[model samples]
Target: MTDSQGQTPDTRRDFERFYAASVKRLVTVVYAVTGDLGEAEDAVQEAYARAWPRWEQLVAEGDPTPWVRTVALRLAVSSWRRTRNRVRAHFRHGPPPDLPGLAPDHVALVAALRHLNPEQRRAVVLHHLLDLPVEEVARQTGSTSTAVRSRLMRARRVLSAHLTDSPDTPTAGAGRPATAAQPRQEVLPHE
Candidate 1:
């Protein structure tokens, strides 16, 4: 009845079977309630870990799911509350100040970068400033290398047009740093 450590083999096997059959479905239900895959996964895994030490009792008392589900859902609610509070605290700091620099042109370049969409800005910074390859950048951003390359190309055209001191720069961006919210067409000339 007992294994090397005096734990019953039947109890361990039964718990393993129950876990294999239920974990994915449990996570799906928890994700529906939590609306975040990562959070749901964390909560459900923690619940299962907690249940392991109590497996014999849980299994003998009928289905162990209700116990695990209740614990996981409660943890999800706690996680949501913590996240909401952190967001509120961050917004209280107000918007960040504009990027600073010694040279006006450098400042202007940094400002122009702000106008790019978040994905494009990341592609430029990671590739050009950090000198990372396109494949590495794509890996960091969870995108394919081809998509990252395209982003870098468009970003370069946009940045090159924005960074120049020529007449195009003065008229195109109006001597102001770009914000991420600006439309790309506003900065790019129509072909």
Candidate 2:
């Protein structure tokens, strides 16, 4: 099948090639955005699936990659918002009174995480929890590496303070959080 642009209107073969070429990179970027590998992969896959029907049109227009990227990102954000709303509704009273097996330190850490803004929390999760490099984190989060560095620096400072202050939270440092000011040093983009 041919489209008006003289491109193949049928997407199966082209879509297969496109999927094989783009899936990994898309999943990586989406993972950075969603901070969940499963969610990221799902979003990208869903985006590609949606694009399948319009593949010829998308390719005729321009790069299907960016279109897929945008759609996947929007899907991720929409899913996040929906999940957040559900959690809010579920915890209208509170966070289920905390789990019984949760250690005191864990509870305090969870509390501190809850105190952080969404972006800060994401910075923490992507860089720290998920162990993504700063550059990858920046790419996924749609921010510059410098911005991701700043977010991590600030988030670390806040987490350190929060942990240090909590009786249950223990610290390996000298019990003092580092000031925002620091000796000039290059931040590692990939660590």
Candidate 3:
């Protein structure tokens, strides 16, 4: 069956083509957004699954890849937010233990990212790390373009401030318990 766009209705063949053509790129985008390879992979898979039935609608509208990517990323973000909330709840109840294999640099980066509010981090990662256009990022993030720009600016400032602080040089509260070592593991996006 085909849609009004003259394209074949979504079928196994269409799904296979979409997956083959876009999986890698989508995985990379998911990884950049979520910072967790396993989660990103799962999210992408889920997104593709969800898109399969609506393939005709998606294909008729435009590039289904972006739609799938956005869905995957939104799912990942929702998962991340839920996990973060649980962790925060746990920490509030008790002292959190140190994360294993965490290095100072990684710790610093994570800390810096954490320092920024979630919106800022999302904007920064989408715009800078993933190199997405502001409009696209806004679409993916469900924010107005102007809001995305503002978030990107704020996130950049926060990241810059955190990165600029010399690791070797002591800043106020440098040795405080709040400081944690970075994770040593190199998080590579799944191929």
Candidate 4:
């Protein structure tokens, strides 16, 4: 098949090969972005579907993985935004039912994430948690490298302060030195 871009798109055999090669990596990126396995799978599938018609354009550009990832992340973010509104409405209307098997530490971590503004959280996750270089993050986020670096610096400072002040940390007067038993788990939004 040829695409509007006047390039020969992938044939059935080519698509099969591509899917077999790329699905796992694409899903991993989606999972990192969405933080929900089910949603990540759905989003990645959707992106793959969209990419199908544009296969020629993608193949011509060489390596469609990044394009697929961008689409998946966008879809995941859209879904998250919609769900967030529903959650807010549920909170306002009535008491929420308890979720079972939710660890307190996990709850605390989510709360800590909520404390950060979205950009700061994204910067922290993309850089520190994902181990992406500043340039890559800047490219993904459409920001200058310097801006990404600045945001990462600010995020680290804020996170450090927040962790240090948490009740889990020991005070100077305590016989033992203050250190969290388990290091905080960082969620990388883009990996």
Candidate 5:
């Protein structure tokens, strides 16, 4: 049986299989890129939708992982650019509302991640979270390996500092002032 694009059922199945296998990972990667899970999921879904038409060609040429990732990242970047002004304005007036249904550690990690600039965050996510080599990250980010290394170093430092909770730092829900000094947490380790 052929679909509207004249592609066989096997072609549709291939795309479906690819989507099922990679969608979660793609969303996670895009979330690290966008610092917003909702936006990441939306961007990845859109990217997959776009990829549907070119599935056959993408499959014929090579693995479509890079293509889908690139498209999702690009879509996320576009969305970020469009919303940046609004975000800045919102922040100027007040802090972001607390997110519900997320673990404290997850919230802390994400908050620490926000301290990094886009380049640094992207480098950290690509190299550490995604387990890509520095060379591959450099290729993906269009930077030299040295640059990626530098960004990773800086990002790790920032994340380390941010994640480490000082005695003065208020605990998320603790009624008391803060507990005893906690050990310095290493959210991102040095290379």
Candidate 6:
């Protein structure tokens, strides 16, 4: 028997089984590469949705993992490009004058981030906030892993200096730790 979409029961079952087995791992891999969990999940979901239409062909080819992964990675990269463009446009046009005030810590963090050059900022966000490894950050940023490490080190120093110097930053006080200004280590290991 076939569904309304013309897929047979066996084909549907096979696709369902493949999705059930692969989704979690695939999302994890994509997240590691992209450094953004939301984008990773969206890309992986789109990849699986694409796979549904070609389930039989994928099965005949032996394993669909590689194909789905490639699609998801590409999608994630595309999304990143779009976001980058939007950011560029926003900078060119400038922020709206009516924007609400931010918390003091957040304001301090933004001020610190502003002190970084674009490349350093990207490296800090990807490797530190997003919790991507140096190698993966290098891959995404088109630099060597060593270069990524250097960027991270430099960024850390710069951030520390900036945060510590800012009077508005709570962490600037002698008694308080500057943890908010520091790059946090990832709790989970990358795949």
By lDDT, the best candidate is: 5
RMSD from true fold, candidate 4: 10.3
Give each model's clash number.
2, 0, 8, 0, 0, 0
Candidate 3 Cα misplacement greater than 4 A, ranges: 1-10, 85-115, 164-191
TM-score of each model, paired residue for residue: 0.42, 0.46, 0.62, 0.58, 0.79, 0.47
Winner on TM-score (3 vs 6): 3
Model 4 regions more than 4 Å off = 1-10, 87-117, 124-131, 157-191
Cα lDDT tens digits, model 1, 1-191, are 77654558887788789889988867755554443457779999999888888887888898897678667766866786689665345335522354223355544554566456657866776677556798887876679999999998888777766664455543454533334334446567789
Q: List the residue pairs that clash in candidate 2.
A: none
Q: Which pairs clash (backbone N, Cα, C closer than 3 Å) in model 5?
A: none
- Candidate 2 matches the true fold with a TM-score of 0.46
**Model-by-model lDDT, in order?**
0.67, 0.68, 0.70, 0.65, 0.80, 0.71
Estimate, for each residue in 21-63, the C-alpha lDDT of model 4 and write its tens digit.
9887667555444445567699889998898877767878998
**Regions of candidate 2 where Cα sits further than 4 Å from its true position:** 1-10, 85-191
After the best TM-score superposition of candidate 2, give how far the Cα of residue 176 lies from its true spot, in angstroms. 15
User: Against the true structure, candidate 2 has what lDDT?
Assistant: 0.68
Instruction: Compute the lDDT of residue 106 as modeled in candidate 6.
Output: 53
Residue runs of model 1 more than 4 Å from their true location after superposition: 1-6, 85-191
lDDT of 2 by residue, 1-191 (tens): 66554446445667888889989777766554454456678888899878977777898998887679768877976886778865455434433464556566655555556556657766776677557799977877789999888988887777776665434434335445333324567888986
- What's the candidate order when arranged by decreasing TM-score? 5, 3, 4, 6, 2, 1
For model 5, residues 1-191, the per-residue Cα lDDT tens digits are 88798789999999999999999889878876667877888999999999999899999889999899989998888888899986556434432467656677665666677677889988888888889999999999899999999999888777766666554556533322132346687798789
Q: Can you rank all candidates by lDDT, best first?
A: 5, 6, 3, 2, 1, 4
Q: Which ten residues in a row have the lowest lDDT in candidate 1?
A: 93-102
For model 1, what is the C-alpha lDDT against the true structure?
0.67
